[model samples]
Target: MNLLSKFATVGGATLVSRIFGFVREMLMASALGIGPVADAFNLAFRFPNLFRRFFAEGAMNSAFVPLFSKALEEKGEAAARDFATQVFSFLTVVLFALTVPAIIFMPFLVRTVIAPGLNVCIDEAALQQALSCEDRFGITVAFSRIMFPYLASMSLVAMVGGILNAYRRFFAAAAAPALLNVVLIGVLVWALWDGQDTRALGFAMSWGVLVAGVAQFVMVTVAMRMAGFSVALRRPRWTPDLKRLLVLAGPAALIGGITQINLFVGQAIASFKPGAVSILTYADRPYQLPLGMVGVAIGVVLLPELSRALKGGRLDEAQHTQNRSLEFALFLTLPAAVALFIIPEPIIRIIYERGAFTPSTTAAVAAVLGIYALGLPAFVMIRVFTPGYFAREDTRRPMMVTMASAGANTVLSVALFYVMAEQGIALATSLAGWLNALLLFHGLYSRNLWIVDRSLVKRCCLLLLCAALMGGVLLLLMPLLSHWIQPGAGIGVQVLAIGILVAAAVASYFALCFVTGAADRQMISRMLAARRKRGARNA
Candidate 1:
């Protein structure tokens, strides 16, 4: 399959997952709102997900895919399988050791690392007599313990996913995340049907997270087997290959650690104000749609693709891959960021306003979402650029760059928390994302590892102009459609309004792209022709 085809495979699946995620978040808002239980559940899940990203997605993808791809490219499937098995055995043992202690020490983690701001609730009079501090803290601990096992499951999933992507089987692993949303949606549906309270729903959802993790692991494992590869855990041994994998992965792990620390700092600060954590999370969902679709597609597809190209000493192919991935990331993300920045409230209102999600809550979430939108391109570009480093097995540079950005994020978040509440935290994160992206870009360019192709640079400038025009269109349209998207509007009306706005915005943007020559017709034709050929081959 071609590059765009691979992107479509992963991106199409991620789009499904993100859609289900939206439905799941909407149900969650209805059942829990931004209440104590919502806060606890968001915090609980964030804790495990932090490690999931740190150990699994960020570290494993960076280290594992390249090594595995190199083995498959140079050595053979047998060598690749051996290396994968060793990593699997060692990773399993490590995750087991990690999960047990995490669950056992859940309380301490909650009090210190997870959500330190929750300590304010212990003082009762410190913030307000809002809810039971003891109850919130206790359930948060319980929820964390219940869901911590998910890290193990997802770690295995990531390992298997790396194996699959190394073989260019992208759909299964990308689709696995949708199962989480589906499982949680089922849990919420049952809770809503059974008339469960917020506390009961929180416990149910936490368990649902663990179950979804297992499901995802199973899905990816099956995909690997079907692809004629299987990983059996051997007794743990420090094979040279395993040592090399860890050596490469270590810096990536630290990178993930720093990034998660930045996130935890934001969450901790948000925890000081009631509902701030959930508000930020809710605001995060809309922009995540585009990020997940474009950014994830690029990250997952580009790494393995680049590894193969660079391993074969195909410098031109690798450079072309980098340039196209960068162009594609910006093309899709810029308009999205613009739209989110221009009209976040309408989007947030349409999605979350139905349930216990109040207009006031919508306002708060919308503000944060707008700030996040400003950084959307940066977030996606990070994905595009990092593969340039990782595909060459250069993990340390990105780690150092990540450290600088995370440090900036920390200082800025602390500085801004006193001024703007949750929105301040969001702004810090967005700014940090840009810093990370720019530094990564400069690192690549300065080393001549990623030379700026003329097409890429020109298309980027044109895309920016197109996005700006689209933003202007949305600005003109939002006020005109305010009644249809207002708080008390019918859900159908709101949906239709959003649909119309999106259609108009997208139509105008594409039209402008074609008119201004930002979008290459011949390149699009090749993508389409490749799609046809692949379909014919399948038939």
Candidate 2:
């Protein structure tokens, strides 16, 4: 498949997953809102997610995909499958060892690492009377223990996903996340129907997480087997291949560890405030949509593609792929960033300001969303640039850079939380993202691995111009549509108004891009036409 075709397959699946994820989060908002239950759930959910990023998405996939793709290219299916099986065995052993201890020490971890602020009991009587900080802490510990096994399942899912992506099977791998959302949404609906209490609902949600992880793992494993790469579990052994994998995974894991630590720091600091964690999480959901659809899709596809190109001595193709990926990422992400920055309030209100979620909550979440939007482009660009290093099997530099970024994030998040509250934490994360992106970009450019072509540069400029125009249009239109998006409005009216606003922004952005020659109408038309023909032939 061509780059855009592969991107479309992966991106389209991710788009579906992200949409379902929004539904899941919206339900979560209504079910839990920004109280102790909501805060506790967010904290609990974050524990497993933090580890999943560290092990599965970050370290494992980064090391596995390129190596696995090279094995497929150089050796054959048999050799590749053997490598995958070995890695799987080793990973299974490691994750099992990790998960047990993590579950056992959940309370200690929650008290110390995850949310030390939750342990504080100053003004205990008032806290007990109002939010019940101690109760929230205990619930967070319980929920975290229930959800911790997801790390193992998702890590295996990521490994299987890497194998599938290497085989150019992106859809099932990308679509696996949607299953998690679907399962969670189902559980949410069932719990609501049963009229469960907050603690019971939290337990149900935690169990849903575990079930979804297993479901996702099963889906990807079946897909991988159908693709003729079944990874039968075997006793772990220290083979040379396993050693090489570990060697590469070590630094990559450090990078992932650093990145997750940055996140933990932000969340930890936010936890000190009464509802800051939930507020930041709610605000994070919309930006995650574009990040997942654009950044993650590009990264997943780009890594294996770059590895294959470099393996075949296709330097020019690799460079072109990198450039095009950057251009495409910016093309989609810039407009999203602009829209989020311009219309966070209306967007948050339409999606979340109902049930227990209030107007004040929407305003707070919107403010965090706006700050996060500032970092959206930077975050996407990090995904684009990091593959340049990973494809070259250079994880150490990224790890070092990540350390600096994480340190900065820690310092800034702590410093700013007292000043800007939750928004400060969000702002710190954005600034850290920019710093990380800049460092990655410089690393690539300095090594002459990723030199931007003039055309790519011009297109990026045009994308920025279009995004600015879209932002201006939104600014002008938002006031006129404010009444329709107010908290008091009916759900249908709010949805319709938000939909109209989004459509208008997207239309104007594309129109501006076309008028400015940033995007060529003829090129897009030809590409779509070609894709259709290819599809027909396959059919």
Q: List, in order, the clash count of every candidate structure.
A: 0, 0
TM-scores for every candidate against the unseen true structure: 0.97, 0.96
- Model 2: how far is 460 from its true place, Å? 1.2
Best by TM-score: 1
Model 2 C-alpha lDDT per residue in residues 1-539, reported as the tens digit of each score: 67877888889999999999999988888888887787788888888888788766577778888888888888998888899889999898888899999989888999998888897764544331255667878889999999999999999998999888888899998999999899989988998889987778888998999999999999998998798778888888788878878877877766655445666688888888777888988988898899889887898899888988888999999999999888889889999998888888888987888777888889999999999999999888887887788888898899889889988999999899999999998899999999999998998899898878998889988988899989988888888888898777888998888888888999999999988988746646766887899989999
Candidate 2: worst 10 consecutive residues by lDDT? 122-131
Give me the runs in candidate 2 sitting further than 4 Å from their true place: 122-131, 254-260, 520-523, 534-539
Cα error of candidate 2 at position 238, Å? 1.7
Each model's C-alpha lDDT? 0.88, 0.85
Candidate 1 has an lDDT of: 0.88
On the 0 to 100 scale, the lDDT of residue 507 in model 2 is 95
